[model samples]
Target: MVTPVHIRPKDDEIYLDCNATTPVLPQISRAVSHTMEQVFGNPSSSHITGLQARYILDNARRLGCEVIGAERGQLVFTSGATEGIQTAVLSALTAVRKQGQVTAGKYLLYGATEHKAVPQALAHWNELLGTKAELKAIPVDRNGLLDLDFIAQHLPHALMISTMAVNNETGVRQDLATLEKVIRQHAPGVPWMVDCVQMLGKGQLQLAQTSIDYAPFSGHKLYGPKGIGFLYVREHAAFTPLIIGGGQEQGFRSGTENLPGIAAMHTLFELLLDREQQVFKPVATLGAYREQLLAALRTAFPTLELNHAFEYSVPTTLNFSVRGVPSRDIMDVFDAANIRVSSGSACSSKVTRSYVLDAMGLDDWRSQSAIRLSFGPATEQATVDAACARIEEAAQALRHSCLLLSDTNEDFDSELDGVVQLRFDAQCCYLVIDRSAREMAVIDPIPQLADRIEKLVACQHYRVKAVVTTEPQGDDSTAAMLAQLLCASGCDAERDNVGWPLAAQADCSTPVDCDVPTDGCLLVGNRRLYRVGSRQPVYLLSSPIEPTAGARVDFAFVGEQAAPQVLESVLGEHTLVCRKWDDDFAIASQLRELKGEG
Candidate 1:
């Protein structure tokens, strides 16, 4: 029996949502705060400040290098593990594209439940490559575990294989060591990549001990900073840089590094390793909590079904579905009571179910009813008891449905459509623009932002001419932030500034100036050459979908009166505009004017 920490429980704010992001460890917080103040110098700088920072950052890299069992110089500190994955994937694809084989198609072999980012990015690539690589999803059994024999059958024809060391949703260990043995015995040459984002810091990574070519782990997940993570790339394993310039990270990635986050990430790893007994005691406490949790859940909802066979699952994560009750509804109700919990995958807390659940052959009802209750080192027994009780109460509350739950009555109430239901709630902001074949610019994308805009326009009629940041100086509090997000969407982003050179056909830097005076006349062509086009009835969603899908407005429903307001707003501008609403939002739109309207 592993000894647990004597964490004196104070107040009960049981945060069982550690799967999303653990709170920054006190050690990491102190280190990052110190680095922010003392090591403000750039590691790439040559002066004393730079030299000092370089030494500090080098130490950070060395720490990461040592923790993951890589050589001192082999490990590259990335802003986060997401960047690491992007760099690795882009590198792999670039290498494949460079081989000059006309019909050479390198497929991205992935397990069914891999994180959404990996598959989504690859899906975009597959669409571009008429025959890029066929996406072969190795099947998982009824227990949400991968079928090794299934993977064994597919490797002969696959060029690359990517799997997770642990499932983020179910916490099911993938028997990676065993999986590696299978790979060594069967398919030796194919590059095997592991996404250890959910596995790192819990124990040793042993990258050198294993034969995997690349692995990704985020700093935030390891009780480090939110924005930094690292990727382990074995020496001699060639991959392309997603961001090409500045020659940073041994030419694997480019851009000014988030040294602070990286530095703290390194400290988190060091501290975690140094205090494995202290920091990871949550694992044992979680084990005990897990048994209690399962018992209570089984008692309250006797029809509870574990998402996977419990014995093979990791102690930190618990995914189970209750009969009849929607997992989202249960989560929402408990959340209202300040008891935080997540469902299916923490990545999309409101999305209800994960692609992982769907891939596991769960029906929509079964998948939607699933909730993931993960534990951390600090979780207390009483907190677990309260959280479980709250979950049951919430589940019950969700079932008490009344069509008119609100006190307000709708008489002529058709005016609520001026909102955008973001298709994906995880978005930082929404892009509201006319989708035309005209030239465009990215508003303001940081270097970290990948080819998102380009991908959005690649197959479409529209052309992205440039980018702009409404808040360029990051002063009027921010422009680079919104622009940086565009890269994540996969488009080249550039800041729009007043004396900037004109490679762009359109001015992208204009502050959306939501408060500015505007009659919506979208200028297409040039100031003197292009077309001034106006399209009426612009629809807003909480998020944007593919440009090819046309204008679809969607938002979540928050109350009884919410849906009706959506229809009214759409009717106000365009009686025929496509609209969807709920407790999600209050939507509105605008239609182009006809000759008489002026």
Candidate 2:
């Protein structure tokens, strides 16, 4: 085990998003710091200080080549995999330009499940070079394996093709040897670039023995520093420098050498290739760890389904979907327990579904609810045990089914019990269901989600008991529509002379007619709603209301000008505050536990 130079802080969170990026190792940090302090010099100068820096850079390059089984001249240091991709695409298109006129009907192809960077880089450089080559995506099977038949058909007219050794989301590995054979058989001279970023430390690579023209590796993915990576170029392949400056990397790339980052990567490469020390876990050990994690997940979620088959993917990642839960809910519960996971590539935010899973033809539910859990190469057994324990507790909390629904979720028809919060744009609505009686109430319904509410009520055969509006009603169309569907009653306080209603009001045309209590408290079934006095009136729900004054407030609906101090004084700290424009929504049970509730 690598020892820390200083005392480490208490680690309260479990980080399992290593596929997105790994935390820098202590040894790597030391190496970077050492280089910055002792060997700081410009490698381009011809002085003694410069020669010392040059020695360090050259040694790092040689070690990188050895780790990947490449030769001395094959590796060129880059900022990251993205930069390497840009360089490779530029070189390939430059070679095509060197040939006669650009041919019509030519295509540039990439794997359908590739990281967004590959196809994007291909399109960017293709347009800049005026190649006009049609870009196409090679389809993948449900296992996320590239379609070889598609490649064979398009190889004759291809300018270049890009593929990944390992997928980031699914952890699926491709049959690179078979792919290489087919490419050479169809078009021998065409340039092939493989995104080998995820393959480092997880699998072996022998670049010299293969016919691959370009391959890129990133340091951050394998526990080194970010903003540092390398690209491998075949000696006989056509080459052009993407960055042109004072002669560097033999004119292939141009920049002052990042000596500190290079030194950190050198330390990482040493650890990976060190057979004697064996710092990283062996294949068998990692396989055993994966089995333990899978068992824990199955125990937590009895209906768990793997997104990709185990035999085809790397052991470090597990992409899965539970039958009834959405990914946002899962992430919320996990975050409450201090466990970090992801839905898909961190590069794409606010995307509700995984395009990778969609391209593989998975069901809409699976694609919309997939969660990715990834482990670092050096994850310890103790950490695994702690993470498994947290997963179990989080799963138990999710079983209560207090779901947070928004426009982004797809399963709007599912009948869930307890309190379900629905969000539309800036408005919030609640569905309080009494499953035993088959009755539900719609609170603060918005016009945008009117159709969804109708479909849900119809599917579940729910009798709409009442439509209650807490604020002054502007557009009563939504209330009218729900009333027409269910013939439900409406409840609201009488409008005061000051233009602000003492409580909420429904239009007279709607079937709603209810007696507002003198204390501004409305009892709907077993729930009690107290209308707090404000500029824009707010309501508090104390469920299963205790006759005692200390009964806990379960939920609160606040308006635009409901002062924070007023809420803090009136409601308990455990109350789930719902605002008009609150960006994040939390599961009711999880939020309660986080607030120190039983």
Candidate 3:
């Protein structure tokens, strides 16, 4: 029997990004280390050590074949799924080249939501092979299923078709049997490649029973080590080698094999395919776990909506979005609670919107705010319970507090809570909020963002305590218009304030809150603002003033006339400095880092 492993380095941390990659199980790690120590001989060497290494390699190949239900020679060891995809694309395009003359108007088809590697590989090899074939993206419905009618329409002139068994971002699985029948019926003898990276442990694939020409898999997607994977080629499929070095894998692939990674995968395969042991959870159990997690999410967020239907997606993943919260905000809250989740494919995290969701025809809000939570097949009940508890806590925190420090007015909406910086043009305004107290203060109000600010104050039921300006204001200024708007919203301001005096204008003994601006310091709620210099007045804010002492300088708002040296004097180690003329200013992530949330 395979022993269950706890792979988390910290007990408090919960990892829910298994779709991107899984933690290396302890047994797999041990297997790798043991193989490195004991089976150190090169398989190409002509000696007893080489024989032992060869035995291990062959055994690994046998296990992989058994897991995927493929024959021995059909499996080729590869670096990972990307290499496999590249190799497959090269082979198919090479075949197109060998077939007398290239057909004009021939198109290469791929699922719109396929991993970036697939389309990129197809485009790369298609140009190099001089096929001059046009590339087409097969569309998907809102549930992330392929449009079969569109596929049938494009199949006649298609050179090669590629589709994924399961999407990496949304966990939506395609109907492989139906897809195969459609391909065979419309375009007989055409090559088809399936990206199977997300399907290894979550589902079974009988490759020999289908007409799929090539399939690629990664080890890290399962519980095995990275840098090791295998590619399955149909028994009589056209083949071309991408890497040509020393003869390896019967001249199909070159370079020395990743023996340790293969050995680790051998252990994982045994756990996956062993029917008698049943090391991994069954489909039904995993589905139940998903429901339980979904319940927790529903309880916490009343407006939560799933990006893909549960009936269509793999149980290991849940892709969803909250109505008003952005993906980055939720990610930050979860991270603060020691729970890890992802926005979308780890490869495309830098890209704000999910192309997969966009291809599915989801609304802009859902696509922009989507969050993916994925767990491994071997996850236990206790871990799920702990994750649910953390999720609830994070949701509560997000609903009550403003986690971000700065954002553009274009990106910021009225639905957010807590303190926020609404930036427009070169200048910015602040909504200093204490949500629990239902109190608010507006600093440096601008007319451009007046509507959004009024909506926020009205929606959140905040009382406008004071409208303060740190600079001179003209009659046509929108600051007065903003005050009138707030008044119309039934938010009566107690004070309409003028600019604070510089250090030279006041005595050192004056109180911080005095209208005369004594000692160059002003107090608004918990925040303390200090005027730094006489010649060029720059205000430094030591923010989120708490009852505890020793509050650090978190933000600095520079004046137009402020000198660099004056600004430098007020800068702290973690200070986020901003000026009116700055092209852009964002400190949400930096503030999280200061609070140990990032």
The models' CA-based lDDT, in order, is 0.58, 0.77, 0.77
Pairs of colliding residues, candidate 2: 490-512
As a whole number from 0 to 100, the lDDT of residue 65 in candidate 2 is: 94
The residue pairs that clash in candidate 3, if any, are none
Residue-wise C-alpha lDDT for candidate 3, range 1-598, written one tens digit per residue = 5455844355688999999888889899999999899998888887999888888788888888889988633888899999999999999888878986565579999999999999999889878777888899999999899999999999999999999999999999999999999999999889999999999988988898889999999999988888999999998899999889998887889898888988888898889877886558999989988999999989777778999998888999999998655687667667777778899999998998899999999877788789999998989888899989987886776566644222132223435445577655345677666666666666677665575577577666677654545565654566655665563233333322243322223222222321223134544456555555433445555656554554466767655555544444556777766554444423444445545676
Give the number of colliding residue pairs in candidate 1: 60
How many residue pairs clash in all the candidates, one count each? 60, 1, 0
Error of 1 at 462 (Å): 55
For each candidate in turn, the TM-score is: 0.62, 0.70, 0.71
- Residue 255 in model 1: lDDT: 79
Q: Predictions ranked by lDDT, top down? A: 3, 2, 1
Question: Over the stretch 1-598, how does candidate 2's per-residue lDDT look in tens digits?
Answer: 6577666533698989999999899999999999999989888879998999898888999999999989734799999999999999999999998887464579899999999999999989988888999999999999999999999999989999999999999999999999999999998988999999889999888888898999999999988999899999988888898899877987889988788999988999899888886557877777787888888889777878999998999889899997655688667666677778899888875898899899899887788789999987788888899988887876676454434333244443464666777764345778777665566666667765575577567666777655655555543456645555653433223333212233433211121111222125544445555555534555666656434433346777765566545555455656777765544543344345544584
- For model 2, the superposed segments whose C-alpha errors exceed 4 Å read 1-10, 399-598
Q: Best candidate per TM-score, number?
A: 3
For model 1, residues 302-391, the per-residue Cα lDDT tens digits are 667887776777787888876544564356544565666687676675685677878888765567677887876545577788877865
CA lDDT of 136 in candidate 2?
96
